[model samples]
Target: MTDRDAGTAEASARPGPGTDPDPLLRIEGLRKSYGDEEVLRGVDMALDRQDVEVIIGPSGSGKSTLLRCVNRLTEFRGGDVFLDGESVLAMDENDLRRRVGMVFQDINLFAHLTARENVTLGLRRVLGMDREAADDRAMAHLKRVGLAPQSESYPAELSGGQKQRVGIARALAMDPDLLLFDEPTSALDPELVGEVLGVMSDLADGGMTMLVVTHEMGFARRAATTLTFLDEGRIVERGPPDRLFEAPERDRTAEFLRRLTDLSEDRDR
Candidate 1:
């Protein structure tokens, strides 16, 4: 059974805030530092099942760090992260990663591997699936992301958007309960950004739980259930997408959104 199946009972039964049970993801008093500089300061957040949570912030604001922490790509100094009512620190790294998949800003595909091979590698090596089983699963996920035709192509043969889509397919093949996107489109050219965003929007619509750090206000406005503004490693504002865009509770949030909007407009024009 998938790790997601193992956690179903706990996820549905654990009590927490609101009328619902505990969220699918919960981070409390999270703190992280690099050398003498602290990157995340007592950060706290939660994401319920099927919730599309978008985080926006200026560069160096600890957005990526938070994603890294969630999957234990980087360890935090304080606070705890819980997934399906189980502490992240207590879970095996492999097990935690299986339940929480990540798509990074960099499309880190193997240059020598075909798109299908790249997607199947994890399944074969980590999940212990045979070549045929792995290939079948990989192709299914590739089709889901609209990349089944490019399955035989190597990373060098694919465009930026296609490579990122492969990354998404690879993540999805794991059957993760939650997906984390760290600036997934930031590295793509403006013309190529839409395709990747379209796939992500589709995932959100299909009830895939996602935590995304992105500058794409359009996607945030259209797909996000909650919009969080992070600045200097702290959550300055968070609310429904419409509320944050139309009337942010904090001046900082308003100004940041205005600047981001202006930048997006300038790019379009």
Candidate 2:
């Protein structure tokens, strides 16, 4: 096995805190594979309501895959995911998705639609709201993300950060039980990253239950109630961001954080 793989395997075997009897989101022994290569291996975690969990790991460490699997964007080979005690695997795909919204790494707004229209689409089609009501709901969410002025603009007319804010508004308009952010600011220019992270910080402060896959340590430190480190598809360490950042319990976690710090420093130079 690779060094990372060996370290993760050993770390994963360590006992963790006892599981809550009633977690808002529960993941048990989650596993996923692509052909012969496994991407997730016996993962387990639980989040209570209003928990903002930030997942950090190197590229190819299964951070994004785990988020996609939670929303059922990708099918898993084993284990179960639960939302509010309902089995996600057993729930209807449409129903499951309504409770779990995802904001992707890339801004996936509809090119032909205006920002307001993009936010209203799910409300109108999924929630079966009339145009007038959907428009009002869309406007409120857009305003929440500080995009009220860009409501009439199309995706191409908006900046990268603006498009991502619209994406966040669209997801929030759904009133989802939990939101998954998959490296939401990774595609933005460094200057634009702060705007999107600002919106996310507000959401966390507002008690939104979120699972975010990101390398943005600033946001994690500021907003994450819990920060998790995944490596070789296993959670090597997880705890409060203050604790994890100040003093990670494992060698692998410390090494990974150091690497990320070096990369961030290099980018700023």
Candidate 3:
């Protein structure tokens, strides 16, 4: 990070809203692997209805995997996922999916459909909202994210920020109690990153309960109610972002902080 980014980070370190609500999502012994590479090893966390929790770590740290398991997009080898106190591991597939909304990092918008149609797909197909109502709801959410004018435009026609905004609107359209974001802006150019992060900042301002796996430390310090640092499939440290990042307890956590925040370093490498 740059000196200017550090100032921005400090400004964002002010405390956010109140404590998160009771476990909107809870995971226990959540393990997932591909071949012999274990992505999540007995990962555990409690996400509440009013949380703006940010998960950060280096690549392959299971940050994204944890979010996927919460949504059941990636099945776990063991453990249970509870949503609003209901165990997703035991629920029917459709029921589990409806309760959790996800916004992928890639901004997977439909090429053929306009932003309005892409945002309205799940509501129309799953919730049975008619076209007119779907359009109306879609428009409202689009306006909320500053993408109302782009609703009629195709994804290819919009800038990266606009597309990501539509992705946010599409997820919000479900009116989900818990929203999971997987590196939502990792693919964006640096200049475009702020727009997406700005929308997220506004969402945090609006008190949306969300769990985000992101590399945006400035954002975590500024917008998150709590910050979690993970490595090797486990949360190494978690707490208020300022304390955790500024004064981490674990050695690995300190190293992570120095690397991610680009803090001053010791003389030796």
Candidate 4:
């Protein structure tokens, strides 16, 4: 099963301050490789409670692979991924998946299933929730992402924007602690990107702990608490969005950001 199929629920949601202190998710010295070609090399990251971190980089930079490693979708060569103090790499698949959720670039909804059905699958199958309870929570999440009315529609019947919303709804139904997004809007048409990102923006605003790997630099700046850049499986630069995007310290980052932003501006005009 993929990391998208979350089979466990660790901590439902985070309690506010004065309740307790726990990092929603943590990663340490995570490494992954295919044979001798290493993709992720000892990446360490820490997100404060409720903080959203965005990772920006070029294609084949291991950004997607890094997110994949977190949910144990891709078995890494070393290191640990923890959500609410539970070790994902060492836990049972169901247990690890339940706490970690991912939204792919292609919005991998079940083609034959209705939007509501897609969202309810995890809750009913993994969590063993009854149809009524699963649908009740699924519909609420669908509505939260502004897709309640399209609940009965199949993936093919919906627009790219709508399909991705259903993907988000499907992931959220499990009530994961850490949400890993691998370019949620990358496959959509330009016009459809905004609707999907709007949902993401709302999620960030609502305090969902998110770690996103995206080429959508504007979205990174808008929705991230911290921004990270990677190249050839190594983190090159990281900082607050404004500082990182506008005044990247590393020359590689400055060059990459310049090219990326210039292309974005050209496309917009």
RMSD each, Å: 6.9, 2.9, 7.4, 7.4
The candidates, ranked best first by lDDT, are 2, 1, 4, 3
lDDT of 2 at 179: 96
lDDT computed for candidate 4: 0.80
True lDDT of residue 106, candidate 1: 91
Per-residue accuracy of model 4 over 110-162 as CA lDDT, tens digit each: 99999999999999999999999998998999999998999999999999989
The global C-alpha lDDT for each of the candidates, from Candidate 1 onward, is: 0.88, 0.89, 0.80, 0.80
Best-fitting candidate, measured by lDDT?
Answer: 2
lDDT assessment of candidate 2? 0.89
Given candidate 4, what's the lDDT at residue 195? 90
Q: What TM-score does model 3 achieve against the real structure?
A: 0.88
Worst 10 residues of 4 by lDDT: 2-11
Model 3's alpha-carbon lDDT is: 0.80
lDDT of 3 by residue, 22-129 (tens): 567777667889999988776666766678889888889899889888878888898888887888877876666666778888999988999999989988997889
Encode model 1's per-residue lDDT on 1-269: one tens digit a residue.
Answer: 22222223322343432114578888877889999998887677788899999999899989999999999999988999999889999999999998888999998988889999999988998889999999999999999999999999999999999999999999999889999999999999999999999999999999999999999999999999888887777777666789889987678888999999999999999
**Model 1 / residue 193 / CA error / Å:** 0.3
